[model samples]
Target: MKKTLLGLALSCVAGAALANDHDDRWMLSTNLIFNALDNNKNLESDFGLGLGLGKFLNENWTLDFEIDHVNVSQEGGGGSVDQIGLGLMTRYHFSPDSSLRPFLGLGAGYLDHNGSNNAQAVDSSDFMLNLSAGLRKEVTDRVSFLTEVKYRLDTDDYTGTASSYDDYLFSMGMSIALGAAQAAPAAAPIVEPAPQLDSDGDGVSDQSDRCPNTPAGMAVDMYGCHQVDGDDDNDGVKNSMDRCPDSRPGAVVDADGCEVQVVIELQGVYFDLDKATLKPESISILDAAVKTMGEHGTLVVEVAGHTDSSASESYNQALSERRAKVVYNYLVEKGVSADRMTWKGYGELSPIATNDTAEGRAKNRRTELVIQD
Candidate 1:
């Protein structure tokens, strides 16, 4: 009678899929089951557990796999009945959009059970057909509560005497949705390597050659330019003619190859109100200094800070030192190497003008960049 009612219920809901219309795509369900074994009058009601993984094929249909384990107690108190089942199921949901969804499912499962008692009569492993109907109620967006009943028709002979075995199950459990908002797979980026060419045949790739054209059979620098045509210091004298190969750029080079010493004041690098902080206007001037350093990679420079004679020698010296350090830090931040630069503070000693006059004091308070060959 119980099997007939379950079959009828399953037929009523068979066409609809057993999933909610919401966007959740993955489901995990766990339930406690009550198993009633027919004609095993010596066995008491058993407790079981069923676990299922379900996927929504669409809003109205779901496909699932379930596994169950049960331990049936013996009324006569000698042994226990153990049963395990595995099933592949499909469900049709009747009300996917509602908070309370009703569904019916049909599946086939393999059930294996054995009684350990020496006097027990049933020990069989058989495949059976099952019918089920269930209700699911949403308790939260990602979770739902479920109640279900199922009946399995097993045709295997039990105790080597019975025609068939009737197995009924009742379950109540929870379902949780998983990975609903996972990010979609991203397309991979395509990268092609840069083309390589050696137009000058100087044993260097053209893409990396600083000087691309050179006469055939002429010795060339690493840059693929003619070695004899190279100027090491870029001071307008070729390396073959310049005696000082490291003469500083833009300097006056004598016949013997030495740069004339010249002092360059860093214009616009001025401080306000006895503070060591550099003014905003000084950034452009310093930026130019950084560019010059990059252009002449081998050039070294000294950053010197100066202050007027109005303050005490000690105070002016400390302030000037701080001012010079600030300039040094700024250049380092701009990617200049620290080893290529040095800093010094000259206080009240090297004034270019008379300290008694305001104009002279303003002129004395300045920063200077001293370049080295």
Candidate 2:
């Protein structure tokens, strides 16, 4: 029964790592214990003590290393037993952030036991496996009280017998959280407002204003210039200097007023199940997108992320947005100009495939790159 619980606790540890979000990282704990050691035909129970240190891989899961020591004396005197152990355990908490949390754990360790001055000297040194269940109650932000019950199996020949030694331990203690290890906040976006018409209040719009920054109340021409200048296309370039006189309105232009072409697209970037994290295999495809953008340095593109209809609408929307931001950040780190990129999430609202099937859902969960020039 104890072995089965240990196996389940190990499974919970993996599941918790991928799902939990809270991030308080390290813990130190101590416990006073009651131990019952059974080695058929002889039973002894006594007081023990333990010390442990734990690290949270995620909010709901922790890995702990512990040392335990116990001493038991025979009722009739002239005999005593001593045991000490060191072990490693993994635990899964049911409610990590609550005032009260329940947890289950599994551990394996080495134990050294010695019996002194007894009619039948019992001595053994071996490895032990244990399963435990516990409850913790918060006393403050950095402190908590803990109580637990554990069953350990000692795999050793006790008095030359074949059966394994089964030990039960009951303990209560306190835990202290260490350091400030919460996850950092997400990055805030940088926003630049669009340039406005008549920004200087000189009675001219920026598109046609040759001297757009002319001092306030200055007298100006149709060109919004302090001096007379002919610019037929109203593209800020004097007509004599205009290389592309018929430039399209709102088109990005060089000093000669010629429009620039900058466009690129990416398709098929994928993510893990219900997560914003990019899958390893999707890196090559995204790198291709990066290469294409690098070849066209001035390209402005939108990176849109989408998800299948599996989770709640709000959750999918937020998750998709994070996924898009992850790709956008990746590109920025790889030398793509941040000013040329924008990102958004479409969530499950714009699925390209049927969400009812696994294959279709996979097809629907993808990111797309669209040229905006």
Q: Native-vs-model 1 lDDT?
A: 0.74
lDDT of 2 by residue, 146-207 (tens): 99999988766555665568889999999888975334345579998667667778887887
TM-score of each: 0.42, 0.49
CA-only RMSD, every prediction: 27.7, 13.0
Clashing pairs in 2: none
Error of 2 at 131 (Å): 0.8
Residue 126 lDDT (model 1): 65
Scored by CA lDDT, what does every candidate get?
0.74, 0.75
Model 1, 129: alpha-carbon shift in Å? 1.4
Q: Among all windows of ten consecutive residues in candidate 1, which has the lowest summed lDDT?
A: 15-24
